[model samples]
Target: MKHVPAMQSLTPAVDARYQTLLRKLITKNGIGGKDSTAFVDDAKKQKLKTDESSIPLPVFEKGIHVNQAPPTSSNGLNGNSPTDDSTSDLSKTVSSTQDDRANDVKDEIMRNVLTIPMLKYDDLKAATDNWSDANLLGRGGFGQVFKGVWLNSLVAIKRLRDTDARNRELIRELCLNQYRHDNILPLYGYSFGGAEACLVYQFMACGSLEQKLRSKSHYPPLTWSQRYRIAHGVARGLQYLHTMTGTPLIHGDIKPANILLDQCLMPKIGDFGLARKGPYGEERTHLKVSRVHGTRPYLPDEYLRSRCLSPAVDVFSYGVVMVEIASCLPPIDRNRPVPLLSDWIQQQARDGLDFASLEDRLLQGTPHSNPGLCREFVAIGVHCTKYSRGDRPTMLEVYKRLDNLEFPGKHYM
Candidate 1:
């Protein structure tokens, strides 16, 4: 008689009897109950060991196995034993499957982020409150600008008139170098799939310098010191854009209306759709631009004559700004062929006029006004406005001269 295991007793009585008869025959064939039980238990233990060994170790975190292997029995219990080569092949298959799954997950994440939907035409209309007149910030040659809020971020959206391929290239270039300067309006992104093209930029709170300069009756007039700082900031920004290496950028248009101010009165240069880069393979020397851009009063005479422009063109524009700051006069008058402001300055310089009359009228009632300081500013202005571009000083030199000028006493008039 063979001692059968208790688990075998759970099987049907008839099957148990049959297994018992087979065990007896094996015993007769020189196999005993103890040897058989030992062999069965050994087979169970080996299968359990293989299952434990097949469990993969966690790669990233606990309980997160990357490649797990299937369980397989070994020994005479199943009448089949897995070969060492089969085990190795199973492991390679499991690893490859896990790798493929990981790659698929990575691809899915990248696709999701890259395909984030841009603003559609209807979406923009809704965000801008149906392009209401109340939301209008300003308008320019490109198109109208609007103040909009999206995802809690305030943005200035420029709705462009034309969406040609050239304009698209301009947007790409501007966006690429948007992070180059702190005093320039940065391009966040753009939308051009609809009937209108739109450019997005960081919102400027205080509007443009033109508004500030022309707002004598409404907002408080900017002081002399404030104007000087604003002018310095603008010069530094232009210098960065014009002189920095790796494809020099030429701001074809520079004017008061294009200079924006923040709440702290810091000036920021904007509107670069008309900017041009120097020719390739050529060292980024001064640009020889031929286009007659910028406002007439601010335009250098060389540019008017179609001479190739250099950074001096910007310096010439800065000189015009200096005159505006000094005299508090508008840059142009439609009624007059020549701007009264520039004509007056040229006339004064020719007559060897004194600096007293050039002082801004806003300083007339201020007790801090100093005639000597005014003289220094006027002299600097004269040097900047020299008829020849070669005679004009660089923005760096202009900044230093302005810095050296002494400010009057708090109560000195």
Candidate 2:
């Protein structure tokens, strides 16, 4: 059989590793044996199924924006409490149907993961001290992460909750192993069956960008320079996802919580649970979804209204994250004069407030703070958050603008 060409633009070592992986995959597909020439053509045509059942496409009630929206009635309207036994029985039936669907998706994921390297469930459990609370790293919509030691190396083990979201994340993360970059979080391995489904990832000593932004003394405050680098790193990672991959991928969720930082504060984008592959070829600009599924303030107007997704959706979310980094404020805080931080920032900027007046209070008087750089940075974010999808800059443009920002003696770029 003919060999697949090694991917271009990768280092020799990375390309060699990819070739090794390709050969192993060919063998696993039963295409490495003699008389396997015919099988190669068929394998090349195989692609991931993108249907609702196969892709974990979420089904949300008509007006729901967030994943944790309140329950709606049978007729798809907000209804008062049911006062009859029949209503209770109906709820049970709906729950059963959801459970069956979740199991089917989980089964498909368990089968797909067979091709990857796996760790023993018991060994992972032991590494985390039987999943003790003390070892907990953080929690997300899909699972709880714990810090652990595996093969004498520090790792983060994520024990997923038994739900459709978990299945979706598991499959997406599996796909990430093939598209490695310096800014993307690396997957070490996975463990499944027995008691829980777990994915092991390279440990981030500095935790998530969200944690650092919201820190109230548990961790040191992030200097202006660190925030600048964090934004640049995240932009590079998102740009890679959009244009570098063979098929452009949209990281549907790009909140600060998904961006992790290493000990030196180098940022790596993580959590592909909500990621979706964008349409292929230049003619196709967007992918239509059954319903909108993402966090608020980060989602763009077009995505929410039309359910049409493109790389711009990710760009919009990244813009919101930029605002977060500059302001050191949560995306949504009901107590604030403006509940949505992105909107508030835009309003304040439009009101002609200087960067010094708009920046995080803690950043004021700090030696690293530079009003000129901060203004330029916030302007980039505002440009990305434009109401019109066509108006926002591509991630590449965003990266270039960030790269041009003056940060003296910074070598990471």
Please tell me which predicted candidate would have the highest lDDT against the true structure: 2
Q: RMSD for each model, in Å, please?
A: 28.2, 11.4
User: Where does the lowest 10-residue lDDT sum fall in candidate 1?
Assistant: 52-61
- Writing each residue's lDDT as its tens digit, candidate 1 over 1-413 gives 22222112211211122233434444465554576665444433442112211221101112212223322432221123244564455445544443433443223322322332345566667678887788899987668999888667877887877534334333333333533687787766556456676766778898988888788787777776677667777877877875575444556567788888887788888877556543223332243221244566776665565333566777777777777766677877667555555565776788889876667677765874555656666676677777887799977788777656566432331
Top candidate on TM-score is 2
lDDT of each: 0.58, 0.69
Q: Kindly provide the TM-score of model 2 when superposed on the true structure, using C-alpha atoms.
A: 0.73
Clashes of each: 1, 0
Report the lDDT tens digits of candidate 2 across residue range 62-136: 222222222232211112333356435434443444444444444433334444576788989988888899999
Per-model TM-score, in order, reads 0.64, 0.73
